[model samples]
Target: MSFLFNTYALARPALFSLDAESAHELTLKSLQKAYDCSLTRGMMASRPELPASLMGLALRNPVGLAAGLDKNGAHIDALGNLGFGFVEVGTVTPLAQPGNPKPRMFRLPQKQALINRLGFNNLGLQAFIANVRKSQWRERGGILGLNIGKNAVTPIERAIDDYLLGLEGVYPHADYITVNISSPNTQNLRTLQGQDELTQLLQPLQEKRKALADRHGRHVPMAVKIAPDLSTGQVDIIADLLPRYGIDGVIATNTTLSRDAVKGLAHGEEAGGLSGPPVHELSLQVIARLREQLGASYPIIGVGGIVSGRQAKEKIDAGANAIQLYTGLIYRGPALIAECVQALKR
Candidate 1:
């Protein structure tokens, strides 16, 4: 922790000077190098593991690394060493695809936000599972959640095939599975949230999961990720249906398409999902609404725009059992994780 704060403070200026995507790629590569060579293993943060129970999975803490930061599961070990109670990787489609074109990611420092349309880009299901197999997080007792999505080329109606494929491939490895039906970057991907579409998408997956659990002798939980742009009625509809489908949890949001928060900031006009400070309140509203309808019986993984411990606590106050981070990590670094843990544990 001391090493990261000191070094990252010095290196942030240089990293921020590069394009967002390039900087991200460089960091991932560097983390991989450091972990493989044992350079960062010693520098990793050490904290009292604040054990928590959510959706039947026992976790070390409530703060988790959200999906999208590691689209391919390549950084599982490296990220796990940084002290997340859990790490979720991907939105990995059944097949590999290039995703949206470059310049698809942009940073708005002024608003503490990022906009991206990196449409489920990754090395596909097989590669993703292989990476997860190589990770040490599971051995260390860290919960690993694999998020699955449809490929850009897959038709909306046939999207179930991709998700089902992901379910079968990752079931043996994941601590939990995230069905990502909310990323706005993929065309009509958000449409899966609609009543009939969502039901159709989840029914088959849950049925298969029952068989998989019986075969593997492990019943891994499944969570659905949704967008923040939905209306109250729409959110209610989804909440009402979660229990019927046997979905174990719901991530309050993926990202928002609304520009209201970053209206005057640079890159606010970009045509993609927006995340960071601007999304904090929007995501909270969704969690609060879900909590109101579902009560404490269901679990909600709150995410979007949490950049500090206080902010993480706010999400819990709004009714999230656990919180995940992504955009905040870019702005605040590893320190945010401890801060969140402290706030939540207290």
Candidate 2:
């Protein structure tokens, strides 16, 4: 583990020199090559077996790789080797759409933050599913989640159609599915978080989930990913709606539109969601609010700005039953996973 950590430390300068998106691509490709050579097996073996339960699924640990990291499910086996109890992919849309324009992703190294308006830019559902099906991680008993969202061209009124299609397509393949209504990159997408709009969305989703469960003879849990910019009242409203609509879990935050924390830092004024350490407190607040409203037992997959094991433990103390990582992986590398697992274990 120390060697892996040292390796990433040595490579960090090169990864950082490139643009964020290009570096992202290079990292994924490198992980794929490592997996192909079976170099990842040792990393997997060194991971602790800290069994946990969340939304009725048994997890090898409570640490998970969050969505948006592998949006097309192309790198599940490679990422799973990094010691996540589960891996989630996609914010994939029903149809393939080129996301936001170039320079869509920016890094704020000063703050250990990133601002991306990638707009669910993915290879569409068909290709996403194909890649998912090609992965060996699921057969290895790792929990995999498929996150669903609407396309860029799809108007908000018709967004339900896209989510329905996503649920149906990813159902048989996923151990769980996440309904992503909270990405800041998509226009009007966060409006789905409102009470009336949320009601309209969740009702049909629960109905569809029931039908899918019956047909597949298995009940796959659905979690809603929410934004960190929400008010206490807004959080409470969502907390009330989730269980009423039979949603299984809540990923406490996506990212924050608020740049208050990153002010004066480079890329701090970018027009996209700000993630990493900047949003950690906001995520914690949302988690605390959700736990207060939803009660102690309701599962919350806490996310946003986790960059360390102490921060990971802070999330768990804040009301997260399980936690996921994204920016942290960028800043801390694979060692953060073991550090987090150890923290939670302690």
Candidate 3:
């Protein structure tokens, strides 16, 4: 494990030297090569044991790889082998897009966080499904959630159309589906969280959820991925609406626009949501608040700034059915996943 970290650290300088967005693309390309060569399979085959059950899906572990890491579903099998209990791909829109302009993603090394305004840069629904169909990873026997959203050009008022389209396309392929209404980069996307708008937006999706279940003879849970920037009032509203709309669970955060913890740092002023240590406390606060509103029965997936076993446990204690990591993986490597699962067992 330490050797992996050492090797990654040795390569960090080279990766960091490139523009953030470009570096991301290069990393994905490298991962694709690794997958093609079966190197990732050989390296990640000795999987850990950390089974968990949430929302009727049996996860191999409680720690999952969050969305954004595999925005196009290209590396599902490769990532699944790396010991994640589950993997989520995409913030996929109905149509493909190039996302925001260059220099849209930044790293705050000192704070162990990432700030990215990479607006749903994906290969669109048809292309994404085609990749999923071709991948050996999707059939690897683990939990997979399809995270859906609107295209960058779609008007906020009509976001549901895109989400529904995404649901229709990926519903059969995904073990579950995540509705992402909280990403801050897309203009006015977060407005869907408002009481009136949210209620209206969710109604049709809920209806489709039922229709799909009946049509396919399979029940795929639907979860809402919310931002950590909301106030208690907003959280309360969400809590009230979740069960009312038949939403299955909540992914406690989707990153934060606040730069409180890394203020004045090199990438502090980057215009994107920040994730890592800065959002840990706030993520816990949101989970706890949601727990209060929804009570112990509601399922919550806690994510943000969880780089250690103790941090993972803090989220569980605050009321998370499971937890996820993205920036932490970037900072600590795959060993952190086993470490977190082991620590949670204690």
Candidate 4:
């Protein structure tokens, strides 16, 4: 653990100095190399027991590396060894995009948060599928979910088409599929959350899910990833709609737009969504509210502001079946995975 911290500390200054987007690319490249050499796998394998089950898939643990860290299906094998019970890849769209302009992602070290309007930049479906096909991780077998989304240019009314396109491309490979409708970066994307719009969008997708399950001879559960900024009314609406569509799970609280927790930080005013320590309370609130509305049996995957084992446990106690991390991993490093796994055991 000290070695991991020291190495990252030495490298972090150089990486942090680069533009955030470039730094992310470099990080992914480094992980890819570590994976090719089997270094990351060896490092992660020394961790304590990390096993759990949800949505009919057995996970090595409940602590998963969230999507957006691996926008495309690039580093699954490398990340898998980092002690994550699962790895969610892609907010892949039907069409590839460059996303928002540079200086789009910013780090607030003091606040232990990140603010980014990355806008789902990805290699399109074809490139994404090619990348997934090249991965050696898929054969290793564990819970791998693909988070799907519509293109930036696609209208909300026709959003289902793009989701369908993404589903078709990723369904065969993903253990489950996540329908992303909450990103604040994309224009009008959140409108799909409306009752009428949600039903229209999900009904067709649910039918498609059934067809895909029959065709593939596997039951691929579909989970919905929602934003953290929702009002109580909106949360109730989603809880009401999820079961009607046969949705398998919900990933509560994507990045938040609120700056209440990180009020005085240097990058606090950045326009993108805020994620990390500041988001913990609101995220937990959403989880608790959803649990009440959806009933205790509904599966929920908690995310946002989970920086420690106790925080992760709070989400679980609030009714999350599993939890994922992005900002926490950024601030805490790989050792956090083992720490959370061990802490959960106690």
Candidate 5:
């Protein structure tokens, strides 16, 4: 086992004893602490090869730390040490808004799942970008994908304004930008996934990207993150529109509103997106559906419920080009990243 895995194993019990959100905060704090102390500096510098080339960006491996884990990009340098091929941070909006009240995040240990309605709570794009620029990881070739969203108070009609602002703010810092329109927590956010709305949203962004690409002399690709709750028809519509809109990639899913697998469990009825093991098969189905529609060459970053090495390989085998993690880190900690990298390399 890797040294980091052993360390996390020792702390796992205590972490599990705390409230889910509290444990999450504590974990992020510890990562920042280790980073500040320079204790993890040389840890994964000799990482074994798990090469991936996605959307014109080079990645050391196919395992990525999903956006919500490092919401404000505050821990990229620390997370980078955990050995992710890429670390995507944020669901940042044009303006910062305190998300749904506390107790917003819940853990369902029995199902090895979690339900959260954090509502895109983040440090806003400016602070998010500042945090990204402060990190040395990107300069050292670490891949960073910034996930952008609209603020809760923003009217649905004006959502594009926020995303456009986020694209502008994060374009230079991000190797790729993810236009997040699938989070169930934000009011009306998921509605943007509809055909007419998606076209309207993506078209403007594409135009802006063209201008940004010219101005910066860099083309930072954009990926659209979708929801697992989508019908096969919805997924197909998205698949057809992606390449047409000039979207660079697609993240197979965000968390789901479906509680099919976690029914009868505590917190099962909680009003939030469900993630972890329960969503595994559902996400895989989305990938299969998306791959059928998107065809082989389009990049698909699979996320939601990827908890082990076997599942990691299973996702790729099911047609995902790469895999990302969030809740799994909470359950298995740093070890999960190494396990996934090892699995994919096989």
Candidate 6:
């Protein structure tokens, strides 16, 4: 563990020197290399195995890598080596996209956070599924989630078409599917969260999932990813609607648009969702409220601003059935996974 921690510490300087997205690409490539060289086991020699389950899927542990980290499912095998119970990839659309623009990702070292408006840039559905099929992680019993989204060119009214296509394409390959309607980067994406729009979106997806389950002879659970920037009423409305629509779970609190926490910091006013410690409290609040409305049995994967084991545990305390990490991994490295698992064990 110390070796891995020290290794990342030594490498952080060089990686940080590059632009954020470039550093991200480099990190993924490096992980793939390390896995190919069979060195990840040494780095993660003591990964704890605290078996658990969520949304009917068995997990080795409840710590998962959230979506957006491996957008195209490109590094599932390599990332699975780091000891995540599950790894979710994509926000992939029905068609390929170049995303927003360069410099869409920013790092705020002083706050140990990142801001990204990458806008679901991905290699489209076919390429995404091909990459997922190439991965051996799921074959090795690692839970894999494929998060689906609509294309930028698709109008909000026609968004369901994109999601339905995404769902059908990814259903057989996924241990679970995440319906991502929360990213602030896409124009008016969050508008789908409205009461009527959400119902329209979920009904057809659930119906499609039912047909796919029968066709594939498997029942794959679907979870909705929601933003943290919602009102109490909004959260309550969603909670009431989810079970009614036959949705299996909810990933509470995607990145936040509020800059209240990072105000006056460099790049604080940037036009994108802010993630890291700044959104931690906001995420916890949403999880707590969702739990109040959804009850103990509903699965809630809490994410946002977890930078420590204590914060990871806090998500559970706030009523998350499981938790995911993204921004924290950027600041704390793989050690944070073991740390979070240990914290959960207690």
Q: What is the lDDT of residue 191 in candidate 3?
A: 94
- The local lDDT score (0 to 100) that residue 304 gets in candidate 3 is 90
**Candidate 1 on 61-84: residue-level lDDT in tens?**
989999999999999988888889
Q: What TM-score would you give candidate 4 relative to the actual structure?
A: 0.96
Report the error of model 2 at residue 135, Å.
0.8
Task: List clashing residue pairs in candidate 1.
Answer: none
lDDT (tens digit, per residue) of candidate 4 on 1-346: 6665566667778888887678878877886677677655465353446678878788878888788899888787777777788889999998999999878999988888899999999989998888777776657765788999989898877899999999988998888899999998999998898889899988999999999999999889899999888999999999999988899999998998898888887978999889888888898999999999988788899999988989888888888888998888777777777777877888
Candidate 3 TM-score to native:
0.96
The alpha-carbon deviation from the true structure for residue 40 of candidate 6, after best TM-score superposition, in angstroms, is 5.1
Candidate 5: 10-residue stretch with minimal lDDT: 39-48
Q: Write the per-residue lDDT of candidate 3 for residues 35-115, one digit (tens) a residue.
A: 567665475454667788989888878999999998889888877767788888998998889999877888888888899
Instruction: Report the number of backbone clashes for model 5.
Output: 0
Better of 1 and 5 by TM-score: 1
TM per candidate: 0.98, 0.98, 0.96, 0.96, 0.97, 0.98
State which candidate, 3 or 6, has the greater lDDT. Answer: 6
Q: Which regions of candidate 1 are displaced past 4 Å?
A: none
Candidate lDDT (C-alpha), each: 0.90, 0.92, 0.87, 0.85, 0.88, 0.93
Regions more than 4 Å wrong, model 5 = 43-46
Task: Decide which is better by TM-score, 2 or 3.
Answer: 2
- Which is the winner by lDDT between candidate 5 and candidate 6? 6
Candidate 2 structure quality by residue, lDDT tens digits, 221-302: 9999999999999999999999999999999889899988888887889898999999999999999999999998999999
Q: Which window of ten consecutive residues has the lowest lDDT sum in model 1? A: 39-48
How many backbone collisions does model 1 have? Answer: 0
